[model samples]
Every structure is written in structure tokens, then in C-alpha cells.
Target: MSSRSLPRLPAAPGTIETGSTLKTLLDREAIDCLAHNLARVHRTLNAKAFRREAREGIEPLAILARGQHLAKVLRRHLPARYEQAVAVLVRSLTPSLSETEGNGLAGFFYLPHVSFVATYGLDPAKNGGRDPFEASMRAQYEITRRFSAEFSIRPFLIKWPERTLARLREWTRDPDPHVRRLCSEGSRPRLPWAMRIPAFVQDPRPVLPILEALKDDSELYVRRSVANHVGDIAKDHPALAFELCERWAEGADENRKWLIRHAVRHPAKKGVKAALRLRKLAAAG
Candidate 1:
């Protein structure tokens, strides 16, 4: 009997409303398969925390999963929770898989854990992983645009403002495009499933440098996220956003166009103007 097929460790004390919410959002088979895999590897507790976090009202599985000696196992741990565990698992699973190095499976499994922590707002105590910042950034991308559309950076800021912002700025130059994308994506005022980052919404100036650095990034993902962040600011401060968009249009690239389109999801006359300028510039070249 795989641990995944088994029930969670002595269920949490309450009728957890979050569990119900998670059930509605996630598929039972997916959870069960993950659970079973964890159980097979003597990590049922870890799987349970992930499942609990994936939904809406379950207990903090990371807290519970920690008892399994997670801290002692891996070298690095993400602050968000369970990210460390998933990273460790990815390392373990990578060798046995094909040429892709399990990036695909890592992505698949990473999603459930991400849904659990970020969406449920449950804290998974620190554990082990390769890089904490990398874990969080990866988790942000795993979620849907809706989560991006509604994410809030408040809690992350209130709890780890300096750390979060520093990470964002630092990642803007990361070699990995996904990590770079996180630099912009994670800070969006309405990043879905994330806490609302009202402060940034009010004063997006702090993040301008980060966006400027990535406006001409080679990575499509990174540029797109930068544009979206700028677009988010536009919603709250149209004049400033328009100015930034104009600047981006100065010598934009193909990826920049995609980013502009996404950033201007809530289109405005300025967005149109920016688009025209970029198009004309491209035609001239």
C-alpha cells in the first residue's frame, strides 16, 4: 500500500475548511498519487502537508511534515515551506528519470506543493532544498494567471520585505529565465494566490529599477513578467506606468512586445501609443 493511497497522519485537530476548499480545486488522483509517492519514500508526512496546503483550510502540513527530520536531510530550505522537500525529491527523482532531468516531473509535483502553501497561506516551516529563493520563484510560476491576477505581495512584504525585494532585484539578473521572471512576477500587485502587495501598488517606484533591468531581457518569460509588473503599476498610476512603457518602447524586442501586451491587459490609450511607437521602430529597423 503506497503511503499516497493511505490517509494523512492523525488528521489535524479541526474540520479544516481549507481542506474542503482544496478538494474543490485539486484533483483527488493527483493528491493521492503524490501522497502515495511520498509514502513509498517514507515521506507520507511531507505529502500530507503538501495536500493540506494545496486546498483552502487544512492544517499546516509543513509544520507537521517537519517532524520527519526534514531539516537534517537537505542542504538548503526555502522559507515558504515544503519547497525544500520538493527540491529534495526532485534531486532524488532526477537520476532515475530520462534526459530531461525530471524538470517536467519536478514542475508537475511542484504545483501541488505550491498550491498548498501560497494559496492556503499556511506556513511550512523551513526545511531543506538547493535554494530557498529559487523554490519560491518556481512556485509562483506554477500557479495560473488567475492567481497572478489576484496575488498580493503584502504578506510577503510585511513578513520579509527586505528579503523578498532583495531576492527580486537579485533574481532580475539570474541566469535562469524562470528565476528572472520571478523577479517581476512575484512582486505584481495582483499576483494571484499571493498576498496583496498594496505598498508596491501605492509606490511602485521601488521596483522600477528591477523592471528596467529586465525590460530587454533575452528570456521571453522574464521580459513578459517585467511588462506585467509595469502594467500592474499602470492600473494604479497610469501616468507613471505610461512613462515607463514609453521608455520600454524605445528599442524593444519581440519578447518586449509580448510583455507589453500582457502588461497592458487592462489596456489604455497610452498602451496603444506605446505599441504603435514600438511597431514603427521595428519597421524602421
Candidate 2:
């Protein structure tokens, strides 16, 4: 959709004038400096769609800064309206974003505030490849974990569940670490911003085998995400996670040790110490 033809966005009620908002933020010397740094980054990136859209008096840098500023300002002054306004603006812009354009916008926005976009996921873009929505979501997921709220991630979590199971098994030999990571990471019940598939969190039976298959995965990133995932399960069901740790602890290397520690992040200290001892024994054996 063309910018001019973009849907009319409702002015968020009680929005302080843009000039006043900018002024207040600039008055804070630290905020001003950070804004300058972020602006420089945005300009250096020279994202095409972002620059073009930025030209209409709303400095892209300022727009980029809006979320962080708004989150702070509105939360203190108008908590009820802050999220609503941000949500409206994001939804209004959704139709206008192309794949790259959307990613560019995602880059401009600060990381902590990515939940505003992930909560919507209104973009029609596909899940992976070069799509901006996909990139944005991946970036958002990597940064924050709370968006794992059930409402936010439910859609992506339940798709072709069996397919994910099959893929995880097949991915161990896929050569591409990205796919390998996806196989383990995407199935995570607490994969930041991803919905908790109760079935997986409750039983995690199917995935236990998959993690076993990929536990010694050569890729650190894949193993890290896998470890964290198992850690998530440990919160909900410790016994299951402990069992998996024991099963995998036989030949523990540093990576395996790290994985076990991560997988048991919230377990009792006794459990953690025991796991460590097991790691030592495995390493020695």
C-alpha cells in the first residue's frame, strides 16, 4: 500500500505534542546523547524505505527514538494510554511495510520495545528467509524473553507440531547450522516471544529425543538455545529435565557441561551440584 493511501491512524488520546515530546527528551543530556548515537546508526545503515518514509518531517531518528521515549514518558504520565497508542501506530503502519522496509523499521526501533510489534505480528510476511517480519521477530526474540507470554507466541508454536518433531530429527545432518538451530530453538516452549505449547512444556517427550540427538551439536548458538529451552522445561517440570540431563551427561565436554547447567537453570542447588559432578565423571570417563 502506498504511503499516501495508508490507512488513517487514530491519534492516540492525550498524546503530548510531538515538539514537546522531543524537547522533554532532549533536555535529558544522557537521552540526547543516546539519541544522537542511535540516529547515527540509523543514518549509517541508510535503509532505503526508512529514509524515504522519514523524510516527511518526522525524523526517522526521532521516530526510532519514539518508543523508548514514549515508554518512559507515557508510562509515568499516562500508563493506560501508552501501549494503546503505540499499538495503534504500529498497526497503522503494518500495511505499508514491504519485507525489507519492515525489517528496516524493526532495526530503527529499540530492542526492549519489540514486544509492541511481536504482539501484533500483523505483517503478511512469511516466517523466514529474507522477510522483514521474520527478521524482526527473530531479532525481537533473541533480545527479550518475556514476550513468551502465551498470547503473543501461540500462533507460531502450534503449527505442524509433528513437522517440527520430524525436522528436528532430520536437521542433525542438515549441514546448515541455521536450520540446525531452528530445529532446536524453535521448538522451545519458552523461546522468548514464542507461545508455550503446553503439550511440549508438560511432557516434552517428543523433543527429549530431539535434544538428545542435537545435544552435542557442533554449533554453540544451537546448543545455547537448546540448553535454555531445556532450562525452561526444568522450571515447569524438573524431573523430566533432570532425566534428560542424566541421559546426556555420559560423555560431557565443556559444551555438554554448559548445556546441562543451562538446562537446569532453576533446579535445586543439590541438583545443580550433582549435575556438575556428573559432568566431571563424564569428562573423565
Candidate 3:
């Protein structure tokens, strides 16, 4: 859609407007920084195209919409092929982390880069590669450790459910909380604001193993993803959500208890019978 045709988005809650609504963590400066860095890493990166695309009609688009716009621009101006474009972008990232560290603005700085990959780099057909699946998966694994690949990995789960699930099962043990969190968050059937995975919504059995492994994760971040994932499931399959919560509730740790409470919050609010029962059990304990 043309920039003029795009609907102007409202400022998101918590946004502090300098020029436009800073609803998304990403802003114009971040976009400019990304383009500048991309050009730095790959001299051939079309600097003019990148800058023009970054500024054109950006004021109207919301954070997520802006990310999508940037991705289209990248596809147009970057190398004609997907693998080549993604490789350059991936290489341009600040050195990969050995262990999850860094916080404050240091960590927050990667948001726009992560947003670009999540929106643009995950698609195989869009990139025009014969088989970029493995490359995309590897890139997600690397990027997630630094920032997060949750939204970016969903397309893989939808396109290659079995392989993606298998990889996620392994990722459950990844030392990086971010990767572990992605295992649960990326597979969520109803992850907010992203496209739903119909297969998961229909029958979430495929994702059960990943959640089962993450129920007692040491990191609150990973555990939160687990709770949210099961909660998404609970919206559609209350019985199943309750069953899992009940199963995990047995000899539950403090962490598991927090997750259980979070998982059922929505259901309990909606007054699902099983959720109410689970809440009662939780209260009694």
C-alpha cells in the first residue's frame, strides 16, 4: 500500500512522543541507525534506497506497520535474492552473544534489527530462495539469543511444523532464556497481534511437549512465555489447559505456581468451569 493510503496509527500506551507517537520501541532514529549500520557492514547496501525508504511516509505507520514497510523496502533494494540479503543483515548484527547478558538501552538497541528480521527475513518465497529454511532457522536461533526471534520463528512453525517443533523441543534446554522463551512464545496459537497458527488452535498437541519441558523453567521470562502459551490454548480448549495446569500443579515449585496462576488468569476471568476449579485448587493450596 502507498504511504499516503496507509492509515495513521495511534500512539501506543507508554509511548512518549517526540515527533510522532513512539508506541513501538522502534522509532525513526532507530531505523536510521539500522540503515547506517547495514551500509557500514555491507558497502554495497543501497544507502540511498535504504534512507529514502526509511523516511518516506514513516510518520503515519505504527511500530509494527513501520517494520513491515521497512521489510518491503529491504526486499526491493537489498540483493535480489533472500539468502544473500539475510546473510548480510545477519552478519551486520553486533557479535553474537555467548550467554544472554546486557540490559538497559544496551539490550534495547537491537529492537529494530530484530523487528526487521521477524517481519521480512523469515519468509522463503518472499526471499526467492529454493531452500532457505535451514538458513532462516539458524538466523533465528542466533538472533533470538541476542534479542528475540519469537514472532520471526512463527512462519517456520507454520511452514514446517514438525521440524520446527523438534528444534523447539531441543531449544527448551538452551541456556539462553531468550531462546527458551521463543520455544514457547513462537508456537503460541494466539500470540497477540501476530497471525494465528490454525493447526495449533485446532489441536495444540504438537506444542504440548515444548510447554511440558518449560513448565518449571528457571527464568521468569521463559516461564511467562509458557504461561501465555498455555493461556492461549486455554482460550480455545479450557479442558486441555486445565488438565495441563493440574498436571503441572502436582508438586509444583514456586515458579510453576506463578505460571499456573498466570495461565488461568484469563480463563478464570471468563469463568470457565475448569479454570474456576483450578483457581479454587490454587487458592486452597
Candidate 4:
């Protein structure tokens, strides 16, 4: 099972054109469509109020900004409490993946749902109660599988590192590849396009165990997240990243070797000898 002895892993899939962008994806038409869906489940939902608010001040906002705008509108039109607001939205959502019909909550509109959680759910979930919030987040994560709660989950990791990390360790063994990916991706210290977890950037030891559990994940999606997690750590802790790369490289399978190579790529690019050495070892092997 050594690095040199391992077979090559399959290459990741090339990007496919989905004909969508942040702006267009959450555009006014999309909002109206979502309102239509919401009204189906929650009869009291003031679809007109929701739609009007979302459209009124949202002319020039970008994707994330639009999410923020809608979140505010939801707060105004939906329940007052964070938990209640989330509950209303959750109840209004199509319950299962089978019902998504290729355009429901599970498909193209998925990221908008994630944005809802980020804009409204995170702080309320945090303040509500730790165990309950965690449970709710776990449920929400099912929806997020189609999108990704990587950014939203970071605040939890920062505020409650030990509890959140413990849950993440458990998530590492989850049946879903997306949940397993979240275990690594959510805790990344330097996750791109999301806020950094300063504690993890300063000391990544807390996240190591979670990464270790996912280093050899069966899914390429999960493995890539693990690799990126390690690379994030390398930005500030090159020595530790190099050390883990070396250790993980030994007696590793193809997937684990892929993880190692990906983890070292950042430092390797920067001419860090230890990282370069690990890359060379993988190449030579």
C-alpha cells in the first residue's frame, strides 16, 4: 500500500457548463419561483409580501448580497424567532430528493437554499442552543448536500470548536459523501470565498483528527475537500502539513496518495523543501 506501489487514482471530472451564475441563479424570476413553491407548503406565507420585499431593494445586489436581502425579507415576513423562521422555510421546502423534480430544492435552486441558512439560520441556530442547533444543522445539511454549507458551518466551528469538531468527526463516517465532505470542507482554515477560521489558521491541531478520518474517503468529492483542508493548513503551518503529507504518503493507497499530492501542492508551489520532497517521493514512487 505504499505510495509508489499504489495504483493511480481516477482523474476528477471536468467542469460542466450549467448555464447559471450567482446573479442569474438568484434573480427575480427565481425568487418568484421560490415564492410559488413556498406558498404551496405554507398557506399563510404572504407570497406577495415576500416577493415585493425581495424585488424592491434587490435590483443591483450580487448573489450573496441577494441572499442577504432575501434573508432580511424572510425575517420581516416569516416567523420572528430564528428557529421558527428556519422551521417555516423547512416545512415549506419539498421534503425529499425524489420530489425535487429536477428543479425543486435539490437541483439548480440548491445554492439559494444554502444562502437562506447562511443569511438567517446560522446566528439563530447558534444562539438557540448548542445541541439543538447542531441537530438542526445536521438536518439542514441534507439539503446542503445539493449545495454546500461549507461557508455557513465555519462560524459554528469557530464558536464551539470542541463540540463542532466532535460532531465533524462523527460526520466523517456519515453515509453521504457530501456530509463526509462537509466534515473536511467546513473546517478549512483558509477556505476560499468564505470567512477564515482564525483559530484553525493559528493552530490546526483541532481539525487534524477529522481530516485523518477522511483522508482515505471513498468519494473523490470528500477526498478533494480533505486535500484542500490540508493545503489550507500548509499556508500557515508548512512543517506540519509536510509532516502529515509524509506520514499519510507511507503505506497509502491510490486515494490517500492523491490526498497527499493535493495537500502538498500549495507548499510545493512555494518551493518549500519538505513539501517538494513529498511530491518528489510521490512522483518517484
Tens digits of per-residue lDDT, candidate 2, 189-243, equal 7766445687787777777776877788887766886888787787777767777
Ranking of all candidate structures by their lDDT, best first: 3, 4, 1, 2
TM-score of every model versus the real structure: 0.57, 0.46, 0.82, 0.82
Better model by TM-score: candidate 1 vs candidate 3: 3
Error of 2 at 208 (Å): 1.6
Better candidate by lDDT, 1 or 2: 1
The TM-score between candidate 1 and the true structure equals: 0.57
Show model 2 residue runs off by greater than 4 Å: 1-159, 268-285
Alpha-carbon runs more than 4 Å astray in model 4: 1-21, 94-112, 119-132
Error of 1 at 225 (Å): 1.8
Q: Give the TM-score of candidate 2.
A: 0.46
Question: In candidate 4, how many Å is residue 251 off?
Answer: 0.3
Report the poorest 10 consecutive residues by lDDT, candidate 1.
93-102
Per-candidate RMSD, Å = 9.8, 13.0, 7.0, 9.6
Pick the winner on lDDT between candidates 2 and 3: 3
Candidate 3 deviant stretches above 4 angstroms: 1-20, 23-25, 95-129, 283-285
Writing each residue's lDDT as its tens digit, candidate 4 over 145-167 gives 55567867877777777877888
lDDT of 4 at 41: 56
- The local distance difference test score of model 4 is 0.70
